[model samples]
Target chain A: MPGEHPQTLTRSTVAVRSASAPAAPDAETLHEIHRQERASVTGAPVTAPLLPAERALLRSVEHAVLDERRLLTATELSALAALPDSAVMALASLAHQVRLTWCGPAVEVEGILSAKTGGCPEDCHFCSQSSRFDTTVKATPFLDTDEVLEAARQTAALGASEFCIVLAIRGPDERTLARILELVPLVHAETGLNVAVSAGILTKDQARRLAEGGVHRYNHNLETARSFFSEVVTTHSFQERVDTCQLVREEGMELCCGALLGMGESDEQRIELLSELQDLDPTEVPVNFLNPRPGTPLGDRAPVGAWEAVRWIALFRLALPGVILRYAGGREITLRDLQAIGMTAGINALIVGNYLTTLGRSSADDLQMLDDLRMPVAALTVAF
Target chain B: MTQLPAADSAPAFCTGCGQSSASCPGCGRDFDPPRYCSACGRWMGVTVTPSGWTARCKEHGEQHSA
Candidate 1:
C-alpha cells in the first residue's frame, strides 16, 4: 500500500491498449483501471478477476514480502485470507519463501516444563487446569528447585534451545514471585538454557523482578481478539493481559506471545487478533490450535482442519514476517500426519516433547522431521 | 557451584528464629513463618542456610537464591 503507483490507465483504457502508449501498464495500474471502470459502470467497486495460477492479491503480497521484504498492510492481509482454494498452494509457497528470507532455514525448538500444575482459579473456557472444570488433571504442588533444575537439564539434553517454566495461576503473589526470582538464575547457571516463564497476569514489579533475575523472555498470550476475549475468559479483562505484555516490554524482556486457534472464533476475529499481535510486535508467536480437552467448557468444540491450520500459519507468517512463528500445542492432534506440511507453511519453531496438559510426540521424532525437511536445528544462542 | 540440600528433605520451620509461626522478614506480618508464608497463605516450601535460601511455592511454583 505504501509503494509507488503509475497513473495512466485510469484516464484512458484505449491509450493503455495502444501500441504507441508511452509505457506498458503494470499489473497494479491495469487492475486499478478495471476496478474504477467497474465502479463507474455498475456503481460498485469490484476486484479484477484473477487467473487460476495467478492470484493477483496473493502475488502482490508475495512480491511485497519475498522480493521487496516489506511488511504487508492489514488490507492486503485481509485480501490474502479471501484468496480462493486454487491460490492456497501458491500462498503457502510464497509464505515459505518469506520464511526462508526473513528467518532462514534453521528451526528453533523450545521445551516447556509445567513447574506448577492445576489449582488455577481463572476459568478460561478452553483450559483443563481451571478448578471449576471436572477434567482429569490433578492439582500438584510446584516442583522442588532441584526437580525443576533436573527437568531443565533434561530439556537441554533433549536438544531444545529454550526452556520455559510454566505455572498455573491467575498471577504470582509475593512469595511466588520471590520463588521465581530464585529459580531463574539457577536454571540458567546449571543448565545453560535460555529460561522463559508463563506466569499468568503479572504486575509491573513482578515483570521487573523477572527481568532482573535473568529471565530471557516472558510469555503471556493475548489468547484471542479483544472483542472475543470475554467469551474465552471472564475473570480478567483483555486490557489486563495487554498491560502485562507492556510491562514485560517496559522491563526490556523479550515477549513470546500468541493465541489459540479453532476456538469457535470467526475468521474476521482471527484477523483482528493478528492485527493486534502485529502491533504488539512480539519476538515470538506461538500458534496453538485448540485440542479441546475433555471436561472443559470448549471440550465439545471441533479441532481446526489440517488445511485450515496450514492457511492460518501461512497467513500469520505473511502478517508477521519477521516474528518467530511456533508450532505449539494441539499440532499432533489437529495437523495429524500433515505436520511436515505446517513446516513448509511458515512455522519456524516448535514446542518439542510434551505440552502442558497434553502429550506431544517425542523430541527425536521432531528432530527427524526437521532433518527430513533439510532445515537444521538452530543453536540455543542463535534464537535470541 | 554451591550445592543445596534436596527440597523435600529441608526443614519446614523458620531458620532465623527457629519458630514454627513467626513474623515474615519481608512484610513484617505474622505468618506460619519461613518455608511457608501465613499472611499470603501460600506454601513457600523453602529452606534457609548460612549461605542463602532456596524457596518454592505451590502457587508460585519455583524460586531460588545462589
Candidate 2:
C-alpha cells in the first residue's frame, strides 16, 4: 500500500499548466507565517454568546469553513447576514477564527496616493472625481515624478510594504501609460516597495506592459453587484471592469479587486457580489464603504452602521478565506473607535494613512492599535 | 467666504467646537477635521492628505489636524 502510485498522477497534461511545477514552501512561509495559535489575536470568544435561532446553520458554516477550509455558498452567507443583531458577535468570532487559521497574524500595511486628483470623465454616482457631479474636487494634472517619488518615500517611511498610485480617470491613455511605466520601476527601485496602479480600466496590451514592467498588482473595483451596477454607474458596465480584472490576471499580476458597500444595494445583492468576487479569484479585496462624497449622487447616503461593518468584514473573510482582506477608505467614519474590532474580524491589511479625498485618523493611532493587539506588522523599517 | 462645495452647505451642529449642542457632541470627541469655522459660520476649504488635513477659513487663516 505504501509503494502504490495513483493512476491519475501519470497523466501528461495535468491541471497545472506552468512550465515548471511550484516549489515547496521555504522557512518563511512554513514557519514564520501563522506564528500565533488558538486565535489569540482576538480575546476570548463571547461568553454565552447570543446565537442565531438556527444554531446548526452557524455550526455548519463553521464546519465547512473552519474544518474543511471551503468557501461559503451565497445561501450560507445570507442566512448569517440576516441573523439578528444578537447573533452578530458570535458570527464575528467564527469569522475571526477562520481568518487566524487561513491567513495568519501578519498584517499588511499600505499607503495610497491620489496621483491624479479629480476630473474623471465617467459618471460613478458615489464618486467625487466624476465631472458629471459638481463636486468640491478640482481637476488637476498628474503629479510630477519628484512628487510621486516623494510620496512613495513617505509611504516607505511608514514601514509600508505596498504603495498604490491612484488616478481619477476612466482609463489610462497612451500618455498616461507612459508616465506610469516610467514611475513603477522608479518607485520600486527607490522605496523597495511593491507598487499597485489604479488608473481605471486597462486594455490587454496595457495590462501585459504593466505586468512586464514590474507592476505588482492592479486595483479595479467591481464596486457592487451586477444586478445593482446600473444604479451606481451609468457610463461603464460592470462587465467591462470584470474584463479588466480578467486581463490583469491573464497578464500574470495579482488582482487587487475590491467592492464598495452601503450604496443601497440589498443584502441579496451583497451576497451575489461576494460570490462573484470568489469567482474572480482576487488575491486582495479592499472592502470600501460608501463615505458619500458631497455633490455626488449618493452624497446624502448614511454611513454604514459600525456593527454592520464588522459583520460584513467577517462575512467577506469567511467568503474568501485566502484573500488579503483589507480595511480601506470608509473605516474612519464607519467604524470610528471600534476600528480595532476589524483587525480581529478577519482584516489582515489596512490603508493606514489618509484615504484618497477624505481625512483618515492618525497613523500613530493605527500603529498603536496594532501594537496593543500584539499583531506583527510585516515591516518595521522606520519609526514614526 | 467660499462655501465648502460639500453637498450640505450648512455645517451640522457637530461641525466643530462651538457649534456643538447637546444633541450633537461635536468632533472634538470623535476627531473629525472641522469642515466649517465655528467662529464665523464660514466653510473651511479643506485639503486632506495622509499626514493630516488643513482647513483654511478665509478670515481665520488655517487649522491643521496635528
Candidate whose DockQ is highest: 2
lDDT tens digits, residues B1-66, model 1? 223345665343343233443442342212111334322334455432211234555544545443
**Per-residue lDDT of model 2, residues A219-260, tens digit only:** 999999999999999899999999999999999988999999
lDDT of 2: 0.78
Per-model TM-score on C-alpha atoms: 0.74, 0.78
Q: Write the per-residue lDDT of candidate 1 for residues A298-373, one digit (tens) a residue.
A: 9899899887788889999998888889999889888889899899989899988767755577678888999999
Clashing pairs in 1: A179-B62, A179-B63, A182-B64, A183-B63, A183-B64
Model 2: colliding residue pairs: none
The docking quality of candidate 1, as DockQ, is 0.02
- After superposition, candidate 2 runs with Cα above 4 Å error: A1-48, A51-53, A379-384, B1-48, B53-66
Superposed Cα deviation of residue B4, candidate 1 (Å): 34
What DockQ do you compute for every candidate structure? 0.02, 0.29
What TM-score does chain A of model 1 get? 0.86
Q: After superposition, how far is residue A234 of candidate 2 from its true place, in Å?
A: 0.5
